[model samples]
Target chain A: MRTKNQKIRDFVLSAISVIVLIALWCAVSTSKPDFFPTPMATIERLVKLFEKPIMKVSIWGHIFASLKRVLFAIGASIIIGVGLGLIMGWNKKVRAAIYPIIMTLRPIPPIAWIPLIILLFGVGEFPKVLLVFIGSVFPILLNTISAVSMVDDMYLKVGKVYKANTWQTLHHIVFPASMPTILAGIKIAISSGWMVVVAAEMLASKSGLGFLITRGRDSYDVALIMVAMILIGIVGAALSIVFSFIERRLCGWMSS
Target chain B: MASKDIKVQVNHLTKKFGDLLVLDDISFNINKGEFVCIVGPTGCGKTTFLNLLTRLIEPTSGEILIDGKPADPHVHNISFVFQEPSAFPWLTAQQNIEYGLKIKKKSSEEIKSQVDKIIGLLGLEKFRNAYPHEMSVSMEQRVVIGRAFALNPDLLLMDEPYGQMDIKMRYYLEDEVIRLWKATGSTVLFITHNLEEAVYLAERVLILSNKPAKIKAEKKVDLPRPRSVSDDKFVEIRKDITDMIKWW
Candidate 1:
């Protein structure tokens, strides 16, 4: 719907916003250079961080270590959450049985489970992944449940009038109908998963952005800590942008 | 009485919501290929009656037979156009039209041919790939109508399908339904509270009394196709149905 000129104008406006943000950061850090670390110093440290291996892994290595865990945890949670949510929402008896369990565990923060998780699963990749899963799965599952409930009774009646079997109704009517809401939940899960993964990595492990921040704290390298912070934000934003693109494509009927 | 020519039989049909009686001992017969309108006053359980016929809900008593057997959605090729916009929003116009066939496990070739015929019939070629949000309100309803008729159903139940449309759009859609009806020769039971709409479309008008509603009258419409509201006979039949409704 937009003309080429309008698109260019919008892009320029957003670019201006990012430049303003960096300029503000530079001004704020000039007063307390040692404590805050200047933007240029952080950028220099980031480039150097890529050159040398901190804890025997490059910047890419640390990034990938965190990325792999978040990806695995979120992917597994989405599958498990959607399946459970669909069944619980569709069948009243199942919902009644599972309702208390979700309510009981959902309030407890993901970080609080570290001790029990470590004891049960041991200190390894699985525990970190499990922590992220605990943090993200509730949002995904709750959203999916709401999504199932959101499907209009009128649409289901139409399916019934056509004599669609239970499987057909679930496949054609329920799943597609609920996708917009489910996608909303996944967005929340991704953000929450990042928060949990970083905390888990900081507490234990020798690699990842969180571990880098821990090492910076020990060595008092403000620039190194700032670099890790910037990377976490950039990657989190990039992941969000990617999923936002997917949501536009998947639920075009709603947004369009 | 049950007969080969009759496509639908309602036998002592009754419905209740807890202690409240909604429909009391109603019975009717619709001949094959008939376009029958069940007209009633507002809040007179018109929808509940249609729902019972479609078996969306069980009757407190009585049974409805389609082709000499108890009505079953699986056994009968049935379709519906309800007051609500019933087209699946996720599907494009063409996919929505082909939905019933897909569920019935009709081959892809058969589904395509059937959907193509409906697309042409409803003049939706321009919007075959368009989603519901991209269409005008009337256009969306047309897709719903097209979807229902694409089934080439044995019985089509319409519950005030044009209730939300403006007068102009309603007339346009009514004619389209008639055209589809004639082309397919499927039996239709259309429910509406509007006497003019009933007379405009039905071959026979079945009047319902106000709540604890029962069928009070059935008048043959006998007027020719594409009947106008300005015509004397058309007005007379509408008045006759109106008078029956008023007397109750």
Candidate 2:
């Protein structure tokens, strides 16, 4: 059904877009030769990383350490954020009481909490976990609240007329109806959370991609620094792709 | 749970929207198996009455009774088909119809049989797996009606269920509803602004006054079964009701 000319046009457009992007990256990266590496150099560093041995502690060690932190942090975010969001959305009293505190806290950036988190939890996994949780939880919570609030009142009435108890109604009506927005919030949380992990780990963790970047900078090893940067982009892309696949499979019903 | 004559008694049902009264001390009795239509002008509290019946909103100063028993939403077999095609967009037509059955804890086989019967009866076999977004407005309305009827409720409340449809589709759905009503014998209290639809569908039509609405008139259509709009008597009654709605 697709026209040959249209496909050719699309291909050319994609190729041009990539060429322009690479050219722009080359321009920016090459401007400061001592401080920045070229696109080709970064690719070379990435290829070198692949040739290295895989183990619990190698170049991949930092990757694993960062991944662990991100996963745990995201898990905590989902539990606390989604639970509170649902409560705030479902109950007016809960929303009124908790919303002011959340608003007061939300304006402060996640990185700003590093000092306080380190102060309370000490410079360990707890601080990093807390930072990621703080970074990711609000988006999920706020989105869930709005999503649940926006659900058509008719569905709830339908639930009531069917004599659905509180738990059943929440499961059958509110959750499913609010899923699309919740998923969107999770998506935003995830990408932002990944970005935060690197920054958090750079500041604190001794064995993470961010730590690797810091180590590279301290040693003045530009190749390793570029490798870490490349890795961050790759990991972010991979997370989005994986989450999107799961979302599509689970929520195909919602689109129709 | 016994199959006996049940009367839905509304006693001094007064409703207000802040300072503006919507239903002014309205009262009525809907007999078991009777189909009554409440016809009124815009903002005449017809919807408020239906909402009160389903307890979507509590009456400002009254209670609804089923026979001698007080109205209980948890125990009452009451279902609604709204003016908007209110089928859950995520669920297929079949699933929407099966929703009430599932919630009521019907056996799978029973649910299957009932769903199949309703789908076949409503000529919705081809569209059973289609979600609400994939359907035309009329098709979505059919799904809504089928879902309501699947429960086999003791009383069915419809709030302008056909007002959104085109004229041809409305007539077709109206006929379908009448057929279903005859087959199931459920008591129906329909709220509509359309005088023609009220006359065509109901055994008795209750007319309400404008704004601070109250029951202005009630007319029993003793016309024969499968009433025709083209019939002279049907036209006469329709005209009278139209004038009442237009003026009052």
Largest lDDT belongs to which candidate? 1
* DockQ, all candidates in order: 0.72, 0.52
Give lDDT: candidate 1, residue A57: 97
* Model 2, global lDDT: 0.85
- Give residue A144's lDDT in candidate 1 (0 to 100): 87
lDDT of 2 by residue, B63-155 (tens): 788866778877788898888888888789999999988888889999999899899889999988898878888898899898888888878
What lDDT would candidate 1 get against the real structure? 0.91
lDDT of 1 by residue, B1-248 (tens): 34899999999999999989999999999999999998888899988887887788999999999999999987999898988788889999999999998999999988999899889889999899899988887898899988888888999999888999999999999999999999888999999888899999999989889899999989999999889998999989888777777765
On DockQ, the leading prediction is 1
Write down the lDDT of every candidate, Cα atoms only: 0.91, 0.85
Interface RMSD of each: 1.0, 1.6
Give candidate 1 misplaced runs (Cα > 4 Å): A1-24
Interface RMSD of 1: 1.0
Off by more than 4 A, model 2: A1-11, A24-35, A53-61, A254-256, B1-6, B16-21, B60-62, B243-246
